[model samples]
Target: MSLAALLDLRGEPALVVGGGAVALRRARTLLGAGLRVTVVAPDLHPDFAALPVRAERRPYLPADLNGQRVVVAATDSEAVNDAVTAGARAAGALVNHAGDATRGTLRFPAAVERGGVQVAVSTGRELPMLAQALRERIAALLPEPGTVDAWAARREEAVRLPGAAREGALDALRADIRSAFGLSAGGAV
Candidate 1:
């Protein structure tokens, strides 16, 4: 079975071994996760001009994996992507192999964040269409931002209360959970 988890990988060093559309997508996701990314390729996609990643106008070298904790093998060349996967694995870094997702240790999920609520869906083997469909379905089910804010405030306050008091506070919050998003008092969001 696959395990789902939320990780805090901020400020970690990462590498992307491509510069095409696939590389662009992977780079954006890595950047969002707070990873300091460096993309190496002899040529780059036109869209890459807008991203804040470190760009290297050169071919990928195994030496590039140095100090990287995360790697994405997103080049159009399968051989290059495979090499990236091997190098990253040997370096003990989590790798996302775009050419063959199952061969890599990590597969990025399609995600949606709203009102501080994050929903992610992953379909391994690079089934992006499936993952995206599920992500959209889940996003449509999210509550309004106000409901999340109310819950967040309740959580913050409850942290200072005793166990019994905290339970009571949480119970009250649940009873009035409609506080927003598409949620309703007598119906569902």
Candidate 2:
């Protein structure tokens, strides 16, 4: 089973191999995660020109995987995606073949971000639609968007606790969050 964890992609480099809608979506997602994105494609959709990425208007080369923290194969061509997966494996980079999740090292889940919190739901590549539905359901439990400011304001006091005390503090925060969002102590709405 794939372990769930948050990766800090800020300022890290990643590659996306494609020029079409799938690649554009992946590129935007990566950018939103704060990764330095580079998109490789021979002919890009006009929308791609507006994105903040190093646009390599050419066929994806194996060398493009070198030093990348992550790589995504969003191309429609299965052969090209296979080549990208191999290159990424050799380079020790995590890869996601968006067209065929089972062929890649990782899968991207449907996610919802609210202020300082993020929830990601996955179905192990077996059911993306279910994951998306679950994400929407969880999103309904969140407080209003601006409440992150209240959590941020409490950050300094929260982090001052010792490591051993953090768990207890987190429990308290969880209770506070529950109260803020009208959730019961058992976490039901």
Candidate 3:
């Protein structure tokens, strides 16, 4: 499934089954979203030593999957990734495998961030390269950072309105924001 389709990682426990660049990148994203993260590997990239999360230096064990809400297997070895995926699934955790998307329950998306707005793109596991290419194109078409901040402020104001009024006002504000960005009304900003 698409990354956006999955549950939010905020306040959840996520496990990364590697400590290389790929795993580090994945862990960074999860941590950015407020997930509690644990990195398991024999060695970690030097950059990880400065992060505020837990890092366990060791081989992967099935017990590491316990109490995790989401798991990302980003080891260089496909076998290790697959093993982690299996263990994660058995523990009822959603998993994303960096080596092979089809081997896991979820796939990461190429995302663009603007203030409080985040637009993500994915083609399931069918064409990640294509999705990434599209993401770059979309990024180029986005508005300046200030515009996104203004939109977020408007959204917050809209949220204070009553039910139907909130929805209607938010929709209009969203349309105006998209228009200012030269994006289609229904397109993600």
Top candidate, metric lDDT: 2
Off by over 4 Å in 1: 159-165, 178-189
The C-alpha TM-scores of every prediction are: 0.87, 0.84, 0.78
CA lDDT, candidate 2, residue 125 = 62
- What tens-digit string does per-residue lDDT give for candidate 2 at 76-153? 899999999988988888899988988888788999998667999998867989999999999988767778777666
| Residue clash pairs of candidate 1 | 143-181, 144-181
What local lDDT does model 2 show for residue 90? Answer: 81
The stretch of ten residues in a row with the least summed lDDT in candidate 1 is: 180-189
Which residue pairs clash in candidate 2? none
* lDDT of all predictions: 0.87, 0.87, 0.87
Q: Per-residue lDDT of 67-156 in model 1, one digit per residue for the tens? A: 999999998889989999999999999998988888888888899998789988987545889999999998888876777887878878
Error of 1 at 94 (Å): 0.4
Better of 1 and 2 by TM-score: 1
